[model samples]
Target chain A: MDQFTLNLIVVGITFALYIGIAIWARAGTTAEFYAAGQGVHPVLNGMATGADWMSAASFISMAGIIALAPAGGYEQSAYLMGWTGGYVLLALLLAPYLRKFGKFTVPEFIGDRFYSGGARLLAVICLIVISVTYVIGQMRGVGVTFSRFLEVSTDTGLYIGAAIVFAYAVLGGMKGITYTQVAQYVVLIIAYTIPAIFISLQLTGAFLPQLGLIGTHTASGVEFLTKLDQVVTELGFRAYTSDSPNMLNMFLFTMSLMIGTAGLPHVIIRFFTVPKVSDARTSAGWALVFIALLYTVAPAVGAMARLNLTTTMWPAAEQGNALDGPAITLAEIDSNPELSWIRTWEKTGLLGMSDLNGDGQIQYFAEPPAVTAANKALAAATAALAAAGPDADRAALLAEVAAATAARDAALAEATIGGVSLAERGWVGNEVTRLDNDMMVLANPEIAALPGWVIALVAAGAVAAALSTAAGLLLAISSAISHDLIKGSINPNISEKGELLAARIAMTFAILVATYLGLNPPGFAAQVVALAFGLAAATIFPALMMGIFSKRINKEGAIAGMLVGLIFTGVYIFLYKGWFFIPGTNMLADIPANYLFGISPLSIGSVGAVLNFAAAFLVSGMTREPPHEVQELVESIRVPRGAGSATGH
Target chain B: MADKSSANAYWAANLRTIGISLVVWFLCSFGLGIILRPALRGIHVGGADLGFWFAQNGSIYVFIVLIFVYAWRMNRLDLEHGVEE
Candidate 1:
């Protein structure tokens, strides 16, 4: 069978398995629907949380981002550290305590802790906003995966994805989502590791990618990273292990992702499914183990893929000499079986190439200073020719353009690698123009010439990653709406049966909104990720931390802190990323020079979180202390004893 | 239920464990991975330096260990303090 058939079979089987799990685990009551009856095994819950946490971005885009970074994947370590480190904070500071609080939703804890309905409503708003923004990305990822692998329209794929999530989510709620996510974790991890293992073995002759990353390259007999550093730097990129130019921003960005990861409602809710606070703590450890399995392999995949691409274009780069080898010729790209992945990706418009100098060879190198100056002169001469009317001085203007072109060609020919001039072979500017980051992972197996089934498994894995996270986020949003908003305050008299129906209705509504947004996403759908992380980091995380840790933090303080953090982070992001992400509405251009203290908006969440803590402390110090009963609640949650099944009251 | 003083001591012990674990966490990722990276660059691990390993691989391992240690220590503390569920 062809590759498409293989993809259909693998993806179809995964989908059937998820729907079957949903049916088998159908929830019976609000307890089962919302918190999986508080009986999930810590290990199983950890696996499910891993699936819930590793979205399409983690599975499909992270390695690509690392591979394409200018600092040879070093600058991208912020993501690797930031995402995993947050679980430390979760397990140590947040998860066990929250599990002891024994509530169905995050807002429930906030509302009760603060002893205010409005505070609960604010948390609900933040949860909804964060989860909705996050889910849109997942939905879009699902659509993209389907359009590429199954050859369906993005919209059709989104509808299919929404339907699958709805069947599982709306039908089985947390119980179903938990089990399906466990299965998803299995599929995605297998799919991700198989490719990395193959590529690692091919590059370094090491079975374990973790060891392969540091092992010697079998072909060059040099250290893997040392060889990668030599290859990338020879092509005008920084060494793979170089430090980030801006260390402060890197620190803050990592902190923001860490705080944001802990604050995300969907992830935090996973801990509520376990029986005891101790289980909650250990579950976080297991989740990290599962997540680390992928996180540790990603850098290896990135470095190896980068080495592979560079060597494919410049075959002699690995041997410490690039000038001796001719660039891969266009004719080889057309007929070489190994280069076939390029053609497949080109159809998706994620990869492109052009023979600009028409030398039959496709040169993929950074332009030297002289070539840049020459190209500028050529552009000026060409423009002058256009300005002078066709009737006047046509011959002279044409001659001037020709002279400029020759000068540019001379500059290109003068460029040297390994002290050998490009004059021996006529080459021009870079030809591999558009290598989108998504292609690094999506086309990885094919680039290494792995089998069709491996590629199919990858396709299935990407879809599973997108769908599992989408379901988790949808559950968070719907639960906030149904359990917190409607039942907690709006209709306190809502029966358990009535609340379950409301939860189902809310879930259906949330899925419809997500699908609609996925189908017709706002232009800034990608940019709003900063908004999601910012709000979660600034508003939700600080609030939860303080609620448990500080007895002096009264309702007024918590409310004040969340509002201040939310507005500060939101406005700061809007100032740089456009108001509500509308293009051109930004007050300042988003560049390092314009950034406050060189902290990009993406890294501003840490600052906002600080301000949140400050505001809460200042406000609380000036106000009355919380009631005696509230103090008791804090003391009780701290002990982790007497924890019971989640209840509304 | 335990007396208030015992409860307070248990809380203090938990805080102490947390304080120590947090120090390790900060040192591994932010300290060694970023700030002290250049200082530790001379010590090599395979192809890269100690700092690169900390940034990409070592810190993650430390984080995993940190959580399990905290959990194990906290569980023991709970049992010793008559707070175990």
Candidate 2:
């Protein structure tokens, strides 16, 4: 069959299966819809969490950032450090306690714990900001991945993704999503692994899969990773694994991601689905194992694709080449449709081309000024110094010449070449951003020339990834609206059926809102994703952790902490990102310029989280402690075995 | 008070194990990745600095081992404290 037909058939079948699971496991009661009735098996819940945790960004964008950056940037590790570290805080502080509290939702926990309606409302606002920004980012990623891979426009792909999520999420509820997410994890892991296996065999000639990456290359005796590092570095990018940003920024960014991950409403809610506290502990371990299978292989895929693309471009060099490849030659890229992403993106102006010598072949060498007056003056100075003695600074002459040569060479070289050009490298360090990071995982099969089904599996994995996370967020939003707003605060007398209907309506509204954001995405979808972590870091994490650990923390303190946390981090990010993440309108122009003590806004969330904790602690310390009964409850949550049953609220 | 001592022992043991595990966790992602990356530059793995391995893949591998240790050590700690279900 043709590639398109095969992709359709494979992707369609996967969609049908997801919808089938949703219908089979559909929620009947409000509890079932919200928390899957808290009866999920720990191991199964682990798999579901993996699906919930690995979004379109994880499945589509992360490896791309790794591949594209080769050099780690300030915000790039947001995927690695943030996503993984969040679990530590989750398992240690949040999960067992929240599960012990037996609350229906995070806001409900705030309401009961703080004994103030204002605390609950503050939580809702924080949830709306964090979850909406995060969910919208996920939606945009889903749309972009779907459009590119599924052979449909982004609008069609988004609608298709939304419909699929609705069919399962609205129908199956959490129970359905939980069971289906396990299957989705299986589908996605297999889809991701297969291409890696083929590409590994094609490149390394070792078939064992995992060993192919680090093992010596079959074609040449060189290590695969070593060759890849050398190839991209010669092209003027940082080495794959060894790239570093400012230490303070890196430290804070990782912490922000971890805090954000731990704080994310959708991911945390997944833990509530499991049966017992002890099971919750075991389940977390299992989720990591399931996720690690991909995380371990992802870096390998990234390094290997870098090598593979270099070899393809520089075919004459055979093994890995030091020379400029076909990708640099304007004639080769423009004439070849297969390599047209280079041209398509070049027109976006993020990638540009220049012919210094009017040569049709674009040279991509380091173009330090072939010579400079400084070089001449320095040469005269060096000649004098050398004549004077051995006093000449050889290092200075070399560096100056190299610097001058690099500038001229860079100017002489094509302003842009293909296969992720030199300039498209970092996170907010440059003037414009590149979407190459998002394309990393999605473009894997095509880059490797794998089979149609393999490519479609990537497409399917992207959809499964995007759809599952979207459904989870919709569930969180609708739950807050129906349970917290309608039942708890606004009505106080909502019927079960009425609440369920409202939940479904609220879900529809949430999906519509998400879809609008996806279609005409708020100007800074990428920047917003980072801020989602920041906002979560600043607000929910402090409240939840404080509530469980400290009896002195009161409703007023929690509300005050969340509001101050939101405003502090929000204003800092807006001032730097722009009043509202619009690019040119940024109040602060320099990335390092605006960062406090050289801490990037992307990493500022960690500082905000700390501030949140301090504000809550100080404010609570000054006020009254929880009632005696609440203190006993806090003590009870500290242990594992004496956990109470899930409350209906 | 006697019951509280055993309870304290159990909790303390669990806390100790997590404390040590978190130490390793922090060292791998933070210590190696950021603070001590420069110091460890001379130690090469594959073709990159040792710190690079820690940042990209080593920390995650260590994290896997850390969780499993917590599980094993906690299971034993449970027996000592009489807290195991």
Q: Pick by DockQ: which candidate is best?
A: 1
Tens digits of lDDT, candidate 1, A201-248: 999999999999999999889999989888777776678888898999
Model 1, B1-77: lDDT tens digits are: 48899999999999999999999999999999999998998999998989889988899999999999999999999
Residue A377 alpha-carbon offset, candidate 1, angstroms: 9.9
lDDT of 1: 0.83
**Model 1: residues with Cα > 4 Å off, grouped in runs:** A151-175, A318-320, A367-427, A491-531
Predictions' DockQ, in order:
0.84, 0.34
Q: Kindly report which residue stretches of model 2 are placed more than 4 angstroms away from their true locations once superposed.
A: A33-40, A70-78, A152-175, A206-211, A316-435, A519-528, A578-585, B1-9, B83-85
Docking class of 2: acceptable
**List of chain B TM-scores, one per candidate:** 0.96, 0.90
